[model samples]
Target: MDALSQALAKSRQTISAYEDYAERYDQIVRHVPNEREQASLKRLVAIAGTAGQILEVGSGAGYDADFLEALGVKVRRTDATKRFLELQAARGKHGELLDLLTDDLGGPYDAVLALAVLIHVPRDQIEQVLAKIAGSLRPGGAFLVSMRNGDGETDGNYHTVLWRRDDFAARIESAGLVLIRDDFNEGRNREEWNTFLAVRPA
Candidate 1:
């Protein structure tokens, strides 16, 4: 197979392994609490200007979803991992299996939360995914995403792409979104991750 196809195949296999790993996946992760995640959620709430319908893509274990709901925001969660999706469903949470890399799932949300999820997307396809995410939001709606910050390449059984800050920002902007804030924090893995809060341009 070509290099791109090979990479995609490898990525799918890695993600499938993660599905089987379930909560145990955290064991391999840095176990670092994402401060950017906390900050971004606060900004999202502020941009939303009150409780409103929010869509969270890659809502692993529904942690952020539950957090948002607890904060009085209505949250609809979705993830690409079937096992993770099922786990969220089993908890009586609202969520679905969704692949942002694909076109249109549902839409016009007040805001879209995608913390730490985009890292799984292949670098070449990041723009496509971002565009699809932007389309899911209403004009002036916000989109929050976080990714590992690095100039080097890294692969994992689950994560396919690691991105640099400038490159990721350029793609988000090209998707017709305006970045409102960008923050970074040290991860438990000893790597940095960037969180971006953006709005679909009106």
Candidate 2:
């Protein structure tokens, strides 16, 4: 199979596995939040404030959604996995099924938060997906993203498209979003992550 096709297949399998693990996802996660996650959430919520809606792609266990809502940001949570959406629904919050490469993300949202989600998008389709995300945002709207930083692709439980920092920045700007803040986090086992806050020009 071609690279994109292989990545899609792995994405499907990974989503299924995550669906099965949905109920236990939060429970199985480390009690201590990752510093990067906390930092990103703080920045996003601060930007969101009391006005405007935020769209969170790959909501997973809805942890970020919970934090944003508690901070008074109107958030719409979405994931590609059905069971994960169900878990969010069970918490008295609804979530939508969103396929970043295929689905329409109905929005001109004030902010778009996609933490560690685009890492799963295949390389060939990454630019298109980024454009689609940028198109969903309003002018001056923020896009907060975090993804694993490395070289080449890997597949196992899910597909990962590792990226160099400059190439990733180029992709973001090429999609018409200007970079605002950029940073990196070094983790255990060489798991370095790239975080960025980009915005559509007002």
- In terms of TM-score, which candidate is strongest? 2
TM-scores for all predictions: 0.87, 0.90
* Per-residue lDDT over 1-202 for candidate 1, one digit per residue giving the tens place of the 0 to 100 score: 7756765676677669768887775445433334656666878977765667898888877777776777788888887778887776777876787776553758788899987778877777677778888888888899888888886455666654777888889999999999888887787659788888899877
Clashing residue pairs for model 1? 14-157
TM-score of 2: 0.90
lDDT digits (tens) for residues 1-202 of candidate 2? 9776766787797788787777787687544456777777777666655677999999888888887777788999999999888877887989988888778998999899998889988888889899999999988888999878889988777778899899999999999999989899886567998999998999
| Residue ranges of candidate 2 with Cα displaced over 4 Å | 1-7, 30-36, 188-190
> Which one is best on lDDT?
2
